[model samples]
Target: MEEMSVKTGVFGGTFNPIHIGHLVLANYLCEYGGLDEIWFLVSPQNPFKQNIELLDDNIRLEMVQAAISGYPRFQASDFEFNLPRPSYTVDTLNRLAEAYPEREFTLIIGADNWAAFDRWKSPEEIIRKHAVIVYPRPGYDIQTDVLPPRVKVVNTPLLEISSTFIRQAISEGKDIRYFLHPEVYRIIAEKKLYQK
Candidate 1:
């Protein structure tokens, strides 16, 4: 008899500072998404976006750790750190499958990302090789009627919050304590992160 593989949700992002919105959605997925665990795969940077204002890779990773403090089902993965720069989704998924043979990794992304899925590197191959779970975004609408066999849309909270918002608020000296994990907020406060 063979051991069953863990159903892991790969939630990749720069996570400039992991916020409560991130935890809320991931927790919902862990309980309702039929996932055993959710890994917050901290990417060195997003290839699609400009890499102008991102914090240090290790700093972001530490903030992720602080955010997921008590959640056993949540994790912070720096797998992309060691890999070559300009990390592509297809490459990450393929490498993850090859490296972690014991875990069945499913790519967890937003409907916004799904809308631009075709533009990603080897989109078809990503869909064919790995399971994808698309969650709702505030303004993004996902068409369930055209979903592929391995792709499914899960109804999650439509969070309007983002790291950009948090950063802007902090730079303006606004109180954003409720938006982030307590310890993460502490780190920012103590270090004066994002302060202008």
Candidate 2:
């Protein structure tokens, strides 16, 4: 009999502080989607959103590591750090495919990103090459009627939390203890991060 292949899910983002929303989504995707593992790819820089004050990539990665320590299926990857900018999803997917030929990979994204799929680099090529698993965002709706055949809209619960809101709360001196993991919160408080 042929060896059973591992189904891996790739969840890429800036992950400035890796909050509860990210962890919840990963857990949901792993359990409900039957994924073997979910890798959180931390982007060095996001092409969109110019005004966001991002923490250092290394620091962000560390926070993500601390936040996801208890989850056995969750992993943090820095694949985009050495790649050229602006980091295009298509290129990353291609590289991943080449690097891991035996395992099946799925791109995990939110519905809001899927709505703007046309704007991404080589969108058609990306759709042609890999499987896309899209989860729901707070306000975005998935319209499969217009999407490509390989795209799959997953029924994960929509969590209203966002890194933007978390950062804003921190900058304004509001308590964001509940929004983030306890370890992450402790690190942020100790480091005096996000305070303007």
Top lDDT: which candidate number?
Answer: 1
Q: Which digits, one per residue and each the tens of the lDDT, describe model 2 over residues 32-95?
A: 8878999999989655656458888898998989998898998889988988788789998889
Model 1: residues with Cα > 4 Å off, grouped in runs: 46-50
Candidate 1: how large is its RMSD? 1.5
Q: Write the per-residue lDDT of candidate 1 for residues 98-185, one digit (tens) a residue.
A: 9999999999999889999999999999998899999998778888988999999989877788999999999999998999999999
Task: In model 1, state the lDDT of residue 38.
Answer: 96
Question: Each model's TM-score?
Answer: 0.95, 0.92
lDDT assessment of candidate 1: 0.92
Q: How many clashing residue pairs appear in each of the predictions shown?
A: 0, 0
Looking at candidate 1, the ten consecutive residues that score lowest on lDDT are: 45-54
